[model samples]
Target chain A: MDTATKPQQIRLSTTPSRADLEALKIGDIVYLDGLIYTAREGVYKKVIEEGADLPLDLPAESAVNFHCSPAATVNPDGSFNMGAVTATASFRFSKWIGPWIERSGARIIIGKGGMTSKDYREHFVPNGAVYLTTVGYGTGALLGRGIKQVKAVHWNKELGLAQAMWVIEAANMGPFIVDGDLAGNSLFERENARIAANLDKVYEGTRPAVLRRFGETDDRTDEVIG
Target chain B: MIAIETIQETAERLMEKAAIEIPEDYLDGLRTMANTEDGDLSSFVLQAMLENYEAAKQDRRAMCGDTGCPRWYVKMGNEARIEGGPIALEAALRRATAKSTNEIPLRPNRVHPLWRTDHDNNVGIGAPEIEYGFEPDGEWIDLVTVHKGGLFGTDYRMLFPSDGVEGIKRFFLDSLVAFGKRGLACQPAIIGIGLGGSKDTCMVLGKRAACLRTVGSRNSDARIAAMEDEFKALGNSIGMGAMGFVGKSMVVDCNIEVGYCHTGGMQMSVHAFCLSSRRAVARIHGDGRVEYRTDPDWFTDYQRRESVEWTPPQSLSKSA
Candidate 1:
C-alpha cells in the first residue's frame, strides 16, 4: 500500500451544509454522523410514482439516502436485528434518483457503485448533493458497527424487509469514498479514463469473437451502464 | 445411515459459517493483493475489507449486508444411505436454509420474480437450489453451501470450433471489462470460466468452478491449468483493481472447468465469486462424526473422468 498517496478522511453529518460538500474532493474518504435512511426502487415507486406521503421529515431530519438492503429481520417480539449493512449499486436507481433528490432533499447518496458523471451533473449538482460509495462495495460489518440505532422502519408490511425504508442513526459510520463531488467530478470516471489508456496494449493478442451479440460495443471507453 | 436431523443441524451450522467466516484460501489471496496494490483508493478499499472480515467474525455477523442467495451442493458416497431418503434429505436442506435465514438475519433476497412475493426467508420456489453428485466410495456425505451473490458478474456465449482460444480470451475480457467497470462484477474476484458443455451445463460448470474450488486450485488437464494461470495474469494486467480503480489487483485467481460439448460448437460461461466469497463444507459420517472445513473438493478425479467405464485407481484398488 502507498502510504503517501492515501486519501484524506473527514467526518461529516448526514445533513451536511453546502460548504461541507463543496470542500470535498472526489477521492477523499468520509465517515458519516447523524441520521441516514435506506431506500431503493420499491421506496421510489411508492413515494414518487404512487404519490405516497413522506414518512419522515426530509433534510431537516436526515439528508443521507442509502441504496441498500441490510441483512436484517424483524423478530417475533417486534425488535429489529440488523446484522450487516451495505449499499447496493446506485446506477440501477438512476431513473428515480433525480425526482428522489428533488423531493427528499438528500444531500448525500451512499451506495455500492457511483452513478455516471452525467447523473451527478444533472441530478446532484443542482441539488448540492454528493455521492459516497461504500468501501469494498461494502465493509458491511464495519458499517454495521457504526450504527448507533435502528431508529425506525416504514412500509414493512407493504414492501417487505428488503425494500422497506429503514431509518438509522449513525456514529462515525463509514469508510465511504467520495465518488461524486458538489462540482459533479467523479472519481470512477477519472480512474476509468486512466485505465482505458492501457486497454489496447493489454488486449493486443486477443481476437474478437466471431459471433457478436446485439447491442455489444467494441469501444472500450463505453460504460456498461446506461 | 445419515440421520435427517443430523443433516439439518449440520446444514444450519454450515450456513452460519458460510456467512460469517472468510475462508482461508480467499483471505490469503486478498492479503497478497493488498500487500502489492499501489493504487491509493483501491488499497484503502482492500485494507478496509480485511478489517471488515475480522469484524464480521468477532461480532458474529454476516460479512456483507447482501448475504447473497444461499445454495447447496451435496456429494454422497454411493454406499451411503439416508434416514428417510432423497425427499427427506431435500426437505432437511430447505428447512435448514429457512431456519438459518431468520437466525442469521440474512436479507431475504429471494422473491417471486414477477409477483415479488417475499417469504421473509431465503426459501422460495426453486430458491436455495440443491445439486447432487455421487462418489463410488464410503458411507459419508459431504455438504457444501455457497451463498453467492445472485446478480451480475456472469455471462454465457456460444462460439463455433473455428473461434478457437483467442475468441475465448476475447469473450473473457469482454465480460471482465464490461462488469469490471465501477466494480459492478466486483473485481479482484475468483474468475471462473467453463469452456465446454451445453449452455445450461456450461453455466453450472462455471459457477461450480468459482464457488466450489479454492483459490490456487487448477484444472486437472495440463492445457486447461495453463489457461487458468494465463487468465489470472491477463485479468490482473487489465489495470483495474477493487471497485474498478486503477490498479493491478483485478483478479485474485482464475479457475477453469470443462465439459464435453457438441463437436462443432463450443459453449462458454464466466462467473465471479466476489470479494465475500462465502462457502463452507462439512462431511457427516454414518457413525455421527462431523468434520468441518472450507475446501469443497467437488471436482475429484472421478467427477472429471472421461472414461466410458469405471475403473478404480491402482492405489485405491490395492488398498481395497
Candidate 2:
C-alpha cells in the first residue's frame, strides 16, 4: 500500500510542522513517525541491482526507514525469543538510495553508522528525503518504549542480526537528529568538508581516510552530547 | 584428620564445589563486562548480577536460582591413585550433588535431545558431561567447573558462512527468516563466534569462550577482528541497531575465538543474553567454601535497570 513520489514532487523541511520549519536551521532536532516500510542492505542492493522481491511495498513521501536489528528477549510463553532489531545504515548502498526513494515513497533513512556521497545534497534534500540517526547500542531502551504493532510489508532479511526488515510502529523513539536534512547537508557532509580542509594539517597526509570521524575525538572531549 | 572416605565422597565434594564455583565466574564475568561497556545496558546486567549475588549472600542462597548444574571436567594426576572413590565419573559427582534446592532458578530453556522442559537438571541420566582433560597437570584434583548458560528457549544458535561483500547479506536474510517465524526469545545480545573448530567444537568453543572470564574483552586475534568490524558495520549498514528499534550498534561486541584444524569446519554460536544477560559465577574450594566475584555497586545497579548506563573501565581486572 504505497505510492511512488519523486523527490521533486514533494517539498517539506526536517521538522514535521509547516510552522516549525519556518524557523528551523542546522543543528535543530526533529522527529518523524507514520508508515515507514522496512529494508536493509539486501533490499536496497536488490532494488538497485537485482530487482529482487522486497519485504514491504510502501510509498516514500514522508515515510521513515530504520537501521536496526534487536536481539531476543524472554518469550511470553516461557519458550523461545528474539529481537526485532533495526538496520545499520543507508549509505553503503548509496548508489541505489536516490533511485529507490525516488521510485518508492520512503523519505527518511534511520541508521546508526555513517554514510557519505559526492552529490549527496542534490540527491537527498532536493528530492525531499532526509537522513536520520538513532542512538547506537540503545536497543533495549528503544524496545522498552513498547512497540504498537509490527507491519510485514516491504520487510527484508539476509543481513542477519545486523540487518533485517521490520516495520515497527514506534512512538517517541528518539533523541535522534537529522544528520542529513532536505537541503543536501549532513554530519557526514560537514565532517567530510572539515576532513578535506584539514587533511594536510591534522592528518599529516598519512592517516587512513577510514580513520576519520570514527573514535577520533580528543580524550578530554565531552561524553556524547545528546 | 577425618577417616578415609569412599570414591563417592570425593566426587560428591567435587560436585558440591562445582555448583558454587561456576556461579562465581558467571557473576564476575558479568561484572567485568559491566565495568568495561559503561553503556546503559551493560549497567543493568551488572546490577542484576550483583543483586543475585547479594540475594544469595544475604541468605546464603545459591548466587543465582539456576546455579546451572556444573559441567564436570577431570584429569587424573600421573601418580595419584583413587582406591576408595567411585571409578565412573557420573557416580562420583552424584554424591556431592546438592540436597539444597532453595528456589532453584528456572531459565527460559528446554532439553535439546527430547525438546522438552527439564529445569531440575536431574531429569536426564547423563544430564551434564564428565569430560576428562588428558593432561597430567598434577593430582591437585583440578576441578574445572564450567558455567553453562544456554537454557534452550532463550538461546538459539546457528553457524553460517561469513556473508560475502554485500555485508552480512546472508545473516540478515536468515534473521529475517527467524523474525518471520517470531521465535526469538531475547532482545540485545553479545554474539560469540568460534571460527575454524570442527563444526560442533567451533560453536561450542565460541559459546564456551563467550562465557569465559573475559566477557568484556575484545577478540584476541586480528583476522577475527576484521570480521567483527564488518559485522558491526554491516549490521549498522542494514539498520540492525538498538533492541529492534531503528537505532545503532545493536549487537554489542561479537566475540569470536578461532581454532585451527587440519580440515575446515566453522561453527558460530549465538546465545542471546536477552536485555537481562542474567548470569552469575562462583568458585568453591575443597571444603565447599566459596569465593565470590562480580561487578561492584554502580555496575550492578545499572545491570538491573534498563535506563542506567555507567562508565566502564577500558581494561578488565578483579579490582572492579
Candidate 3:
C-alpha cells in the first residue's frame, strides 16, 4: 500500500544515530542524500569472506553500499570520467548482503532486482538493514548526475574502474523503491505469489492440453524448471 | 576487394552508433508504449527512459550504463572478397572495438574468470563476440552491431524431439516469468526465441533475433508466429510492468526464429534485450561505398502476421 503512495525524502549517512532505517517501510520511495559507497560482486567476497581489509577507508556506521560496477574511467590523478554507470543485477549478490551488513555496519544496500527471501528475511530482518531497488538501467546514470565528486577509490588496478570502490557524495541520489525492508517485507515475494497463482489459473491442466495439441502421449516423467 | 581499413572503419562507426543511437523502431515503440501504458507512473517511467535516450544522444554517452557485451553479426558475401581474406575481418573488428572504447568511451566490461584481470578496453580472449553468416553471390558486407545488457545474459537447453511445440512454449513462458520476477531485465523487454538447432546455433539465432528484430515483428512460420503472439500477451499478463511497476505491457514483442536440427533432438535458446535496446546496421560495398540503416532487417525473410488482436490477460497485481 505504501508503495502505491507518494515517496518521502530521507537523508541517510555514516552516523547510525541520525536516521532510523527501521522506520522506512517497504515500497516507500526515498531520495538517498549524502555519501553512498559503490561496490560490486567481488567486493563483498574480498571484505567479508576472504577477510581482505577494505582497500579504502569507509564510513564506520549507517554506511550504504550500492551494488554497481560503474563504467567509469579514472583519470591519471584521481577524478573519474563517469561513463554510463549502472547497477549490476542484484540476485547474485543477494547472498552477501547479510554478511556485508554484519561485517561493515552498512544499513542500506541499494541495487536492482529485489533480493530473495534467503537474505531479505533471514539476515536483513535481524540486522536492521534494507535492500532498496532502483531502476536497473537509466537511473544509475542519473545517480551519476547527483554525485558531487568522487572522494576516493580503491583497487582500481585489480578490479578496474567498474568493479573498483568509489566513495562519492550523492545529493538527492535516488528515486529508490524500498523493495526489501527491515519490516520483513519483500515486494518480489509478494509479486511472485500473485503471478504464480495467476499462472495456475491461466495454464491449469496445461500439460494435457499441450499433449493433445502436439499429438503425443505421456511416455515418461521428467522434471522441468524455468 | 573490400579493403581491411574500410571494414575496420565501418565496424568502429557501428560500435559508436550502437552505443549512443536508439534505433528508429525502438524510439517509436517506446513513445507508443509510453503513451499506451495505463498509469501515470508507467508513462512517467517511460518518459524518463526516453529522456535518458535523449541524454545519451546529446551527451554522446551510452544510452544505458550496462553497455553490455560488444557483439557483431556479420553477413559476409560469398563473392565479395576481403583484402586479407575473411580472417582479416576479426582483426578489423578488434581494432575497431579498441578505437570505439576511447571514442564511445565504452565501459571496460571484459574481465578475467578465475584470476583478477581487466582487459581495460573491453577486449580479451573471445571478447567482442563476432558471429558470421555467409550470403552467396553478393558484393557487400552487412553488419549488425548489438550491445546487450547483462541481465538477460543467455539461457539454453536441449529438449528431446518428443518435447513438442507445447514444451518449447512452456519453457519460454516459464523462463519469461522467471526473468521478469525481479524486473532486472528492465521491461518492456524484447525476447527472442530460437528453436531447433545445435546448442550454439540456437544461441546465435536467439541473440540475433533478440537484437535485430524490431518490436512487433513476427516469424514466417504461421505456427511459430502464433507462438510469438501468445507469448507477447502472456508476458504482459504476468504484471511485471515497466521497471517492474504495476501495468500491462511487460514485453513489447517476442520474436521466434527457427532452424533445422538433428532429427531426434531440439535445442532452444532464449535471449532478451532490455527496453533501451541499442543496435545499429551498416553495409559496405566492395568499391568502398558505405550505407547505414536503422533496421537490422533480420525479419526480411520471416512471414509477418498481418493482423492479430491482442487480448492481454488479467494483471497479477490487480488481484494482489
Candidate 4:
C-alpha cells in the first residue's frame, strides 16, 4: 500500500453545492473552512418527522451539517460556552439523513464512524452528496482551535442543547476523509467485505488448537451481522 | 462515620474528573500508538487526541462532547458507616450525577424511552447505573466511575454449550469486522471479553473488564492472559486504523475475564471501549479524608508487559 506521509490540504467552502460535492471523490483529505451547523438526534427527527423547517437558512449546495450535539454550557445571560464537540455514529441517524438532505439541500454529512453502504449507494450518490468522517482524535481540540465563533443558537429553550441549532464559524478546520463519495463508493463497506473474505482461512489455521481444547465439529457458520 | 454530604461531594468530583481526564495508563497506550505507528493519518489522529486531552485538562473542560452514561462500580467497606445510613449512599450518588451534569455542563443524553422526554440533567429512572460490591474489613469506601458512550451496538451474548472457544473468537472478530466498516468503533478500542458466566454476570464482567482494567494488563489466569495477548495481536493484524483508515493498530488491548458457569450454557459478552476511555476512582475514609484518583488501578495485581507487534502479510490489500 502506498503510504500517505502527509495529508493533502484541500480547502472546502463551508457551504458546498451539489456540484462542489460531486467534484470531491472518495479519499480526498480536506480542510473545511467556513461555517458549519451542528444538528443531530432531535433536530433531524423534528425537521423530517415533525414537519419543521430546518432552523437555519443554509443553501442546499454549500450546506455542511455535522452530526454532533455539542456540550455547550449556557450562560446566565443566555450565551453559550462551547465545550467539547465531536461526532457520533451516523448510522443511528441514517433514516433521517436522506430526508434532511432532501429538505435542507445539505451537500455534505460529516460524523464519526460512517453511514450504511446502502445510504451511500442510494441516498448519498444519487443526491450528489458525500459522507465524511471527522478525524477521530482532537475533535474537541479542533473545537478549541478552529471554532472562531458560535454565530447563533436556535430553539434553545424548548430543545436545549440536545436539539438546538448552533451556527458555528470555523477556519482551516477538518482533516476529514470522504468515507463515502458521491460516486457510490464506500471505504468502510469495501474493507469489511475484504476482511470477511479472509476470516475462514484464519479460522481454519487455528481450528486444530480449538478442537483440542473443546471437541467441536467442523461444520460451523459464523454470522457476525444481525 | 463518613457523612452522606461528603460522599455526595466525592461522587460529584469523581463524575467531573471522569468527564475531563483520560486515565494515565490509557493515555500511555495512546501515546505509544501515536509514536510507534507508521501510518500518517493514524499518527496524526493519535497526536491530535493527545493534544485534545492536554487542552481539556488545562481548560477544565470535558475531553469529549459525549460525557456518556454513568456506570458506577462501588466498593463498600464492611465497617464503613454513613451519616444517612447505607441506602443513602445511592441517593448521594444520584444527586452527584445530576449536579455534575449541570456543573460540568454534561450533555443531557438520557432520554425517556416511551415519552421521549429529555432529562436535561442526565438523570432519569435508573440513571447513573450503580453496581455495588462489599469488601470485608476494608476501612474506606472506594468508587470507580466509568462513563460509556459510543455508536456500536450489542455488547452481550449467550453462548450454547456446543459452541467452543473457536466460536467465541469468531464472534469477537466478526463483530469487530462489521463495526469497523460502519465506522471505527472508537479505534484502538479496549475489548473486554467475559466467558463462562451466567448471561448477566458475563455482561457485567465484560463491562468491568473494559472499564476497570488497565491497558496491556494481563488476566490472573495464565491461560486467559495468553488469550489476551493472542486477541490483541489478531485484532491489530486486521489493519483497521484509528478511524477505519487502515493502520497497524486497531486494538490497543483485549482483556478477558472468565467465571464458572452452569453446565447447561456457556455465556459470554464483549464490551468495547474507545481509545478516549474515560474513568476516575476515589476513596473516602471513615475519618472524612477523601482521595481522588485518575487511575482505577484495576489491573494492579496483573502484570504489565511490553506490547508484541504483529506484522501483516506482504500481500495485504487495503480498500482506501
- Compared with the true structure, model 3 gives a TM-score of 0.85
Off by over 4 Å in 2: A1-26, A52-57, A60-62, A72-87, A117-119, A143-146, A153-164, A188-226, B1-320
TM-score, chain B, model 4, is 0.89
lDDT string for model 1 (A1-226, tens) is 5576679999998888889998899889999999999999999999999999999999799999999999998888888899999889988999999999999999999998899999999999999999999988568899999999898999988998999999999999988999999999999999999999999898888887788889878899999888
Model 3 is docked with a DockQ of: 0.30
Candidate numbers sorted by lDDT from highest down: 1, 4, 3, 2
Report the lDDT tens digits of candidate 4 across residue range A120-192: 7778777777888777643664564567777888776767676777788878776677778877787666655
- The positional error of residue B54 in candidate 3, measured at the CA in angstroms, is 2.3
Model 3 lDDT per residue over A1-226, tens place: 3345544556555344424777777656677667778877767777877898975444562278887766667666656777565677677776677777787777778877777756777877787778887764555456656667777777777667778787777777656777787777887666555456556544432333222324332321110111
Off by over 4 Å in 4: A1-5, A17-23, A60-62, A156-160, A193-198, A205-226, B297-320
lDDT of 2: 0.39
Of models 1 and 2, which has the larger lDDT? 1
User: Each candidate's TM vs. the true structure?
Assistant: 0.98, 0.39, 0.85, 0.86
What fnat does each of the candidate structures reach? 0.84, 0.01, 0.33, 0.43
**Superior candidate under TM-score, 3 versus 4:** 4
Ranking by DockQ: 1, 4, 3, 2
Model 2 lDDT tens row, A1-226: 1122101112233224424333333333344445444566556666667776544555523366665433322234533232223234344566667777676656666664334534346566556666665432223333323334554433222332223455555555443444566556655334333323322332121212221344544321111211
